[model samples]
Target chain A: MGASGKRPGGRSARVRDAVRQATLGELAEHGYAGLTVERVAERSGVHKTTVYRRWGSVEGLISDALELARDEPWPIPDTGTIQGDLRGIVQLVRSGFADPELGPVSSAFVAAAVQSPEAARALHEFFVARHDQSAEVVRRAIARGDLPDVVDVREVIRVAVAPVYYRLFVAHEPVTEQDADRAADAALAAARAGVL
Target chain B: MGASGKRPGGRSARVRDAVRQATLGELAEHGYAGLTVERVAERSGVHKTTVYRRWGSVEGLISDALELARDEPWPIPDTGTIQGDLRGIVQLVRSGFADPELGPVSSAFVAAAVQSPEAARALHEFFVARHDQSAEVVRRAIARGDLPDVVDVREVIRVAVAPVYYRLFVAHEPVTEQDADRAADAALAAARAGVL
Candidate 1:
C-alpha cells in the first residue's frame, strides 16, 4: 500500500503511522523499560484517551509497532549467484545496523526481547517473517545447482547474519563492510561444504 | 586463587565478594534497567554508605561484577581434535545459557551493555579476555594441521559462538544441543574451507 492506503471502514492510516513512528522514537530514546503510554501519545500528537483505548497497554503498543515495522516493504536482493545474493543480504543488514535512527531502535528491540516474554515473541515473529521472505534467495541458488537441495535455507541466512549481530549486540565491536563480506563468505563456505 | 586464598588485607576481599554476589542477584531479579545501588546494598547486607563509597555508581558495581566473573577460572576444552574441541566449547556455552540463575544475569548484562557505555566497555573487555584465553584451542588445531595456518582463529571462534548468542539475544529462540552442534559444524566447515 502507498502512503495514502485506506483501511476498510475508513480508519485513519495516518494516525496509525504517526503512532508507530512515535513509539519507535520513544523506544529508541528510553528503551522498553522506560516507555510510557502518555509520552507516546504526546509525541504522536494523538489524544491520550485514544492511545489508551486503542493500544490498551505498553506491550500492546510495542507489539503493534513491531508488526508495523515488519509489514513495511523490504525487498530481497536477487543477485543471480549465491555469493552475490548472500553479500547483498549482508550489506543490507550492515546498513540497517549502521543507520543512526534505526540502529538504536533495533538495539532497544533486542533489549526488550531479553527482558520481556511479550517483546521476545514479537521479535521472534518479526525475524521469522523476514527469514521467510528471504528464503527465496537460497531456493533460487538451489534451483541453479549452486547450493545443495538438502541445505537448510534458514540456517544459511542465520549464519550469514550472525556475526554482524554478534558484534553489534554481544561483543560491542565495530561492524564494518569487511565484517559483512567475511560473514557472507563464511556462510557460503559452510553451505558449499554441505553443513547448512 | 583458591577458595582459601586471601589478599594482604582480608577485609576488603570478603566485602568485594559479598558485593559482587549481591550485584548478580539484583541483576537476575530486576535486570539492568531496574537495578539500583540501594537495592544492591540492601540485598548485599552491606551498608549503603559503604556501597556508595566504594562503587560510587551502579555502572561501577556492574563493571566490577563482570570483572569478577571474568576472573573466575574457565578451563578451555581439549578434545584432541578441532571438531571435538568446538563441540565442547559449544556445549559449555549452551549449558551456561541454560543455567537458571546465571542465565538471567547474563541477559541483564547484555541489556546493560546495549543501553550503557560503561557496561558495554566492561562486556567488551570480558569477551576479549575470554577470546584470548580460548585462542589456544585454534592454535593447537593449526599446529596439528587440523586447521590451515591461514585460518583466522578469532573468526572461527566467533562463528562457533555467534548462533547461540543470536538465538538467545536476537531471535529469543530455544538453543538446543543440536543447535550448538550445528553451529560448531558450520564454523568448522568454513574454517576447513579457509574462509575464516
Candidate 2:
C-alpha cells in the first residue's frame, strides 16, 4: 500500500489497489524470489516504508494482493445440476491460468506456500474461503435432489478440482473447457454411483 | 560440486553429489528463493563453478536430483490385475512424499515448473515416462482380460495420478496407502464405465 494515484475519495484504498497491481506485475516478471517490497513500492509510486508498513513482508504483500484479487467477481454459477456447477467452477479456475499476470502470481504464491508454513496457513484459509463459497451451488443441487445426498459435497468439490489443479501444477497443461466438462461428468457419475 | 565427505571415487562426482545434497538441504530450508549457488558451494565445500558446470541452473540441478531419486527401485507390483498395478504406482508416489528431503524438493520442483518452461519440460517428461511405464502394467492387464481392451491406459494413469498429485500439492495432504487404493478403485470404476 502506497500513495493513491486516484483523486482522493478513499486514498488508502486506492493505494492498496495500486500496491496489489504492482505486486502482481512484479511477481509475474520476477517470480517470488525477485519480488521485493522496495520494487513494489517504486512501481506503485509509494514510499518503501509504506509498502513495508502495510505488508510487513513479501509473503504478506502477496497474500494481501491475492485477497484483493479474490474480491473480483468469480462467482459459482447457480446451475441446476452438480455437473453444471462443476463446469462453472472449472471455467472460473481456468480463467486465472489464461492471464499472463495472474497466472504466474498465483503460481508464485503456490511455490512460496510450499516452504513457508505461514504462507501455507494463509493459502489454506484462502482456499477454504473460495472452496466454501463455490461449493454452495453443489450443496444446493444435493439439497434439491439433483445430486445424491449420500455423496460428501466436500469430496465432490475436491474431486472436481483435483484434476484442474493437477493440470495446472503437475501436468503443466491448460485446463480447457472440454477438460472441465469431462471432469464434471466424471465427478457427477462417481457421485451418482456413491463413489466420490 | 563441493568437498566430498565420503570415500573418494571420482573427485568431481563426489563434489557434485555433495553439492546436490547441500542444495537439497538448502531447498528444504529456503525453498527456491532462499537457495543460492554460493551457499550450495559453501555447504558442500566445492567451487561454485563445479555446480554451474554440473547443473547450469537451479532448475537443472533440481531436475537431475529428481531424476536421480526416481532411479531408485520403484516398481508397479503385479498381482495379475490392473487394480494391483494402479495401487502400486500410487504407493510408490506416496512413498516419495514420505522422504523428508526428497518430498520438499519434489514439491518445490513441481511448484517451480508452473512458471519455468524448462522446469515444465522436465516435469512433463517425468510424467510422460511414468504414464508410459504404468500404462504398460495396465496394458498387460488388458491383455489378460482383467480390464476391457477398450480402456485407454493413458487416461487410467492420469486418474490414478491426478489424485496423488492433488493430495500432495493442491490438498497439501499426505497420500496414504488407503488413499492410493481408493484412487485405483476410482480409475478402475471409471474405466469400467467407459469414462476414462
Candidate 3:
C-alpha cells in the first residue's frame, strides 16, 4: 500500500494494516501452527466475521501478509566494492533471521509455504520481488566492470544467499556472520570464475 | 540397520521397518499435514496401540523414518575428478528429490523439521550423517591435491547442495539439472580459490 506515497484509501488500508500487524505478531509469538483466524481477528480488533469474510482462513491471512511483505522496502547495499556489497546483502539476510522479532515471522512464512500451496504461491511471488531487488548489487558490479555482463546476476544472488538459508532451514546449522561472509565470498569467487 | 552387515534383530526390526515404510508411504501420499499414527498403523497392518506405543505420534513416526534413512547406504561417488564427483553428488541429490516416490517423503521431512522440534533434531542428525558422508568427495579431492587440504569439506557439500534446496523450498523455483551442475561447479570454483 505504501509502494507509492498514497494509501489505498483510508479504512480498507487501515483494516489491512491492522490484520497484517496482528498476523505478524501472532506468527512471531506463536508461529504458523498456533495462528488462528479467530485469534488474529481478536488481536487485530476487527470483527471475527469480517476477518472470516475477508481473509477466509489462517492460510489466507499468511498469504496476505506475504504479499504485503513483498512491497516492503528493502535496502540494497551499494558499498562501492562488489565484495563488500555482496557480503552486506548476505549478512543482512543472516541477521534478519537472527532478529528475535522478525525471525519467527519470516520462518513462519517459509513453514506455512511448505504446507500450503496458496502460501507457496504467495511466498514465490514474494521471492520474485526479493530476488529482483537483491540482484541490484550484481547488476551494479557488472556495470562497474567488477563482473562480466555474462554473469547470471539473479543466480549469483541465489548462490550467495542459498547457504545461509540452507544452514538455517535445511541443514539446521548455526550461521555465524563469518559463515555468511564466506557464502558471499564463495558466490563472488564463482562469479569471477564464470560459473554463476 | 543396513549400515553394517548384521540386522538389529528379527521381529522388532521388522516391525519398525513396516511402521517406518508405512510412515513414508503416508508422508509421500498425504504430506506432513496428513500424516497420522492411526493411518500409519492401518497401513502397516500393525495394531493401533502397538503403533502408538512404538511411534507415539506422527512426529515420532517421521523422526523414526528419518533416523532409519540416515543409516541407509548412500553410494558415495568415486569419480576420479573432483568436478565429476561433486557434480555426481549434487546430481544424486537433485534426482533423488525429483524421484516421484522419494521426493515427497524427503520434502515431508524438511517440512516436518521446520515445525516440530523433535523432527528437527532427527532431521538435523540425519543431515549430520549425510554431510559427513558426502564430504568424502571433498576429502578425496584434497587427498588428490585437486583442492587444498585447508578447504572446509562439509561446507563445500553444503554450498553445492544449498542452491537446490533453496530453489525447492525457499524460492519455490524449478531447479534444472544444469542449475544443479552449476551449483556444484560454483562451490568447486570457490574451493579452488580457497574461499570455501
Best by lDDT: 3
Q: Which stretches of candidate 1 lie over 4 Å from their true place?
A: A1-8, A28-34, B1-8
- DockQ value of candidate 2: 0.42
- What is the clash count of model 3? 0
Decoy 2 TM-score against native? 0.82
Worst 10 residues of 3 chain A by lDDT: A1-10
* TM-score for each of the candidates: 0.93, 0.82, 0.95
lDDT of 2 by residue, B1-196 (tens): 4455465667756666888788788878777656677888789888889778877887776676666555555476787767777887877778777778667677777766765678787787777667777788878978887778888787777766787787667656667777777766676776767666
- Reference-based TM-score, model 3: 0.95
Candidate 3, A15-120: lDDT as tens digits: 8999999999999999999999999999999999999999999999999999999999899998899999999999999999999999999999999999999999
With candidate 1 superimposed using the best TM-score fit, by how many Å does residue B157's alpha carbon deviate from the native? 0.7
TM-score of chain B of each: 0.91, 0.79, 0.94
Clashes of each: 0, 3, 0
lDDT of 3 at B74: 97
State the lDDT of candidate 3 residue by residue for B1-196, as single tens digits: 3554364566688889899989999999999999989899999999999998978988899889999999987999998999999999999999999999989999999999999999999999999999999999999888888899999999999999999999999999999999999999999999999998
Best candidate, TM-score: 3
Error of 2 at B112 (Å): 3.8
Better of 1 and 3 by TM-score: 3
